[model samples]
Target: MRDFLTKKITDIQPSGIRKFFDIVSEQPDAISLGVGEPDFDTPSHMTQEGVRSIQEGRTFYTANAGLIELREKISDYLLFRNKVNYDPKTEIVVTVGGSEAIDIALRTFVDPGDEVIIPQPSFVCYEPITQIVGGTPVTIDLKAENQFMLTPEELEGVLTEKSKILILSYPNNPTGGTMDREALIKIADVVKKHDLLVITDEIYAELVYDEPFTSIAELPGMRERTIVINGFSKGFAMTGWRLGFMAGPEMFMEQLLKLHQYTIMAAPTASQYAALAGLKNNWQETVEPMRLSYEERRNYLHHALEKMGLTCYKAKGAFYLFPQISQFGLSSEEFALRLLDEEKLAVVPGSAFGKSGEGFIRLSYAYSIYELKEAIQRLERFVTRLK
Candidate 1:
């Protein structure tokens, strides 16, 4: 018998985050801050709308591009929030999730040997996806001195004739760093100079703290070249709904929709209706309140970590805190495992994000304030023991 498998798929490393999560799950006494998922339930209105859609027999497949009304709502939401206009009919394709939008975007643009410049420590998906698509993932190490935000110098340093796409994930996962408008303006200038296409993942946009979120797409001359990926998962707490969308120039979207049509056909119809309710009605009531709670938790955890003598960068968006853990003289994975064993508290090793994250550990603030306090106490005890 001959074994049959694509070497590309087999050669890729499994997700480091999930491996730790699996270990923590078997410990019944453990409290996990490992996953990046929002702890809140999907808001009631959105769930009710999903129920209504099912009751009304909306379980059938929508158009390959998704429900027109939902796409229109997404367009309006982006225009009002990000100040970028995309035609619902031609410029947007509803995806299974922002994850799928990412997959399709890479597939639509990257060819074998094309270089996709990815900044790290950031999300884990970009590199593997680029590899699967036969694209070389060129990683730029994001420094803590810069708050993990990608700099123009870093971008320029990684640029080569083969460089085709620059992947920007801000309100970034793992680090929780965000790029302000001025920072984006500098980045946009570099991107424009190099004529590089960009895939900006703004899934965490609504959860930003301290400052208003700005989309790179909103920068002048950027709307036509950037693909903005956003969804109901992070902001609306609808992760289980598995719905997201990509907005960009029609030239790209036209090709993207073809891949979506053949590969996925359409996003789930009921989920589309649920997302519509979220965009249209739940933004003010449900989304804002959840954001406020996350902000409060972020504040509490930041102060707590600092008091424990860890060097923590203040995160302006997303629900994570990446605290430098090198002072303990243990690798991130070793520290996390020991803490879990001694304290029954779980956190993701920062190295899961990238090699540059080796000296850090990412703690999510998506849990309740009470849970956060307990976790912090355990963390302090763990650090004291090391001291």
Candidate 2:
């Protein structure tokens, strides 16, 4: 079996974040902010729909491209919410989740030894998935001074002829940084000039606070050169449902669709039916309240971290508060582990995302206000003990 496995399988590194979780899994009464998922339960209406489908015997295979009704809703949602237009028939493909969508996107575009540019202090999956497909992951560190935003100069510096894919993940995981229209325009200009293809992970698109989350695909020429990856996970608290979709140029999506056909065939049929309901009538009622709750939590967590004298950038979107922990005289991992072991409070080390995250620690505010207050108290006591 070992001899039969491919060289690529041997070259991959196990996920760094999962290692910590495994060690702490048996601990008692730990207050965890380690996972990047929403603490909220999947919306009841969506779940009911899934149940209804299963009861009605709708448990069969779906089209490789997914249900046409679902595709149309995705197209409509993109256009209505972000002013981005995609053809339902050609540009859209329902994926297992944002993870599978990202994997498919990378596999379809990246050839062996091709370099894919990723902004660091971003998501953990990009590098591992790129390596899986034989692509070289080129990381560009987004500076804290720039509010963790990627600059055009950074993009220009790293991008070479071998760079086939550029992943833009904003409302970014771990950092909670997001790009506005002007920032996206700068990167879009660079992408256009370089003739590069962008695979944008906008899963947290609906969680913005101060400014609207702009898609690079909305920019001129970018729509044709961009693959938009989004899902119901962050926005609708639908993480367990494993539903996501990709929209891009027809020619590229054709290749991706074929890959999906061979690898997974299709997303869960019942989940597709439930997501169709989510995309249609229940979207506003089920999703907006959760967004508002997350926004409130963001404010609470940001202020609490500030009062505790930790340097924190005000996140524009997503549910994380990444605080600089260098003042505690420990690396990110040490700080995180010590807090979990001593204070019984769990937050992810920033280094789990990338090397750029070395001096910071990421805290999620997806839990209730009462729980957050309790966790913050533990953190405060932990810091005092350190001193």
Candidate 3:
């Protein structure tokens, strides 16, 4: 069995975020701050929309590109929010999830041996997915000093003749970083010069707290070269719905939809309706409150970590906190393991995201304030012992 396994697949490690939670399942009483999932339920109206779709016998397949109505909704959404226009009929492919968009986008644009420049520590899937798609994953280690936003200088340093695609994941996972509009323009100029395509992961676009979220696609010369990936999972709390979409130039989107049709056929029927309802409904009625809650949680968690004398980088975009634990003289994995073992609290080792994540651990503040308070007390107890 081992001999028959594909060497490429075998080389990839299981998700680091899930590792501690497996221990958490045994601990029973253990509090897990590991998973990036939102603690909120999908808004009731959206759930009812899914239920309605099924009750109305709409359990069939959608169009290969997704329900046209949903695509229009997504189209209006990008145009309104980001000022980037995409033709709903030609440039959108509804996917199983943002994960699938990531996969298909790579399939559409990346050829074997193409170099994909990625920034770390980022979401866990990018490197493995790049490898799986037969592309070389060229990673740029992002620093806390830079707030993890990729600089033009850093991006320029990694470019080569083989560099075909660059992935920009702002409202970055694991680190919670966001790239401001000013910074994105500089990055865009470099990308234009190099003629590289970009896959910008904007799944957390609506949840940004610091300033208005900026999409690279909005920058001049970037929309044509960029694929925008977004979904209901993060902003609409629709992880289980598993609905996402990618928008790009008609040329690229045509290829993405072709691959999606063969690989996934279509996203689930009811999930599309559910996502449509999410976009159709008032943002203030549902997602805004959730974003505000996340912002509050972000502040509280940052304060708690600071009060513990830990070096916590205040990330303004996503829900996770990457608090440095290097002062305790332990690897990020070692710190996370001991904290889970003795404190019965679960968090992810930063190295799971990438090697650049060493000396830090990721804690998702998407949990309740009550859960956060309890976790902090346990963390304080753990930290006191280290001292």
RMSD of each: 1.0, 1.2, 1.0
**Number of backbone clashes in candidate 2:** 0
Top model number, lDDT: 1
Pairs in steric clash, model 1: none
Report how far off residue 301 is in candidate 1 (Å): 0.3
lDDT (Cα, tens digit) per residue for candidate 3, span 169-268: 9899989999999999999999999999999999999888879999999999888889999988998998988989999999888888889989999999
Worst 10 residues of 2 by lDDT: 19-28
Error of 1 at 312 (Å): 0.4
- Please list the residue runs of candidate 2 whose C-alpha ends up more than 4 Å from where it truly belongs after superposition: 1-5
- As for candidate 2, its clashing pairs are none
lDDT of each: 0.93, 0.89, 0.91
Candidate 1 positional error at 255, Å:
0.4
> TM-score order of candidates, best first?
1, 3, 2
Residue 88 error, candidate 2, Å: 1.1
lDDT of 2 by residue, 325-357 (tens): 988789998998899999899888889899999
